[model samples]
Target chain A: MHSIILFAHGARDPEWARPLQRLREAVLARRPEADVRLAFLEFMTPSLPEAIDAAAAVGATDVAVVPVFLAQGGHVRRDVPAMLETACARHPALEIRLQPVLGEAQSVLDAMAEVVLAG
Target chain B: MHSIILFAHGARDPEWARPLQRLREAVLARRPEADVRLAFLEFMTPSLPEAIDAAAAVGATDVAVVPVFLAQGGHVRRDVPAMLETACARHPALEIRLQPVLGEAQSVLDAMAEVVLAG
Candidate 1:
């Protein structure tokens, strides 16, 4: 099975982190067979490298890194890649693929609209 | 002139909030004519309603609510809308439009890919 590593900008507040953790749960519920895990860029536990290593330990040769961020900004442009480079060097055999971020997706837009309209 | 209110999931750690505030600076730098303000859903200072009033006080008739969120989850689908509703009621004359969330945008995806590839 392909392993999925969901990456998010970690938040120190429990409130900020709750939604992301909920999203992780939603992802796994939809794909129970897939080996899914979460990692934070900073300010939280289970950093990307550690998550990748855990995935490798579970016999995952192909891993997909999904960034949970909004907008094309510095963290997405700089830090995440740096962390990924280290993970890749440590496990040269793993086929790592980076998925597009959750931005401008129709469902997501619809969801946003629903929220706004409700308000 | 249009007023832009950026809504972010605030973080307790100064690190997580810094990038978002930086983004606000970038947005302002690009559009100096627009009145841009930052608000948090929770865990930070300067909530959304306060930002809206500030914008109105500055003679902004058209206000855009931008969700600085990644997905179409509960906050985007529920809380934001509810907050908007209250704001709309309080400022009946204001022309408020909820902008499409920053998801799936090419630039954002590019940023995510850049980060991933760099790693």
Candidate 2:
């Protein structure tokens, strides 16, 4: 089975972490066969490298790192990739796919609309 | 004085909320004149409309809704704008500027790098 890592920009309010965790649940609900986990880009515990290590420790040979970010900003373009490079170096046996950052997906946009209207 | 609302994609872990709240604090630390607050896009409390109401209650004539999102997906392009439109309709006196989503900034990328290395 492939292990999936969802990367997010960590928040301080703790409540801010809700959506990302929900998202991880959503992804797991859809793909139960995959080992899904969450990681923070900053300001939270279990950073990406640590999360990746945990996943690897759990015997995940093939891993997909999905950035839960919204844009292709510095995190996506540089930081994420560079992190992957180091993580990959450490886990040479693991097959890693650093997926694209979550941008303006139609479903995500719809979700955002729901938030606006519901609010 | 202008009020600023930082809208985030809420997380379930609460820890996810940290970065955005910290960002708000950072903004407030620099711009004390601005009333900085936070609202979640989903799975959290004090949605955008309610947050706006709170800001309006605090007597902010001009409000800037800065999306803590990353791309121009449906949320940035459509949902957020629609929310602002409704909010504007309710508060005709409020001048709301829907700022662009945070994306691919060199600084943000740098921040991401810091997260990776530090981890």
- The TM-score leader among the candidates is 1
Candidate 2 per-residue lDDT, tens place, B55-97, comes to: 9998999887878775344555667888888999999999888
Q: Residue A91 error for model 2, in Å?
A: 0.8
Error of 1 at A78 (Å): 20
The list of candidate 1 runs beyond 4 A from truth reads: A1-4, A9-54, A57-119
For candidate 2 chain B, which ten residues in a row score worst on lDDT? B110-119
* Local accuracy of candidate 1 as per-residue lDDT tens digits, B6-118: 78777555555655665566666656676878888877868888888888888999898887776445676678888889989999999888775553233443444333333
For residues A1-119, write the lDDT of model 1, one tens digit per residue: 58888788775554556556555556666566878787888777688889999999999988898877654356766777788888889999998877765542333433343333333
User: How far out, in Å, is residue A77 in model 2?
Assistant: 0.8
> Which ranges of candidate 2 are over 4 A from the true structure?
A113-119, B1-119
For model 2, report DockQ: 0.06
CAPRI grade of model 2: incorrect
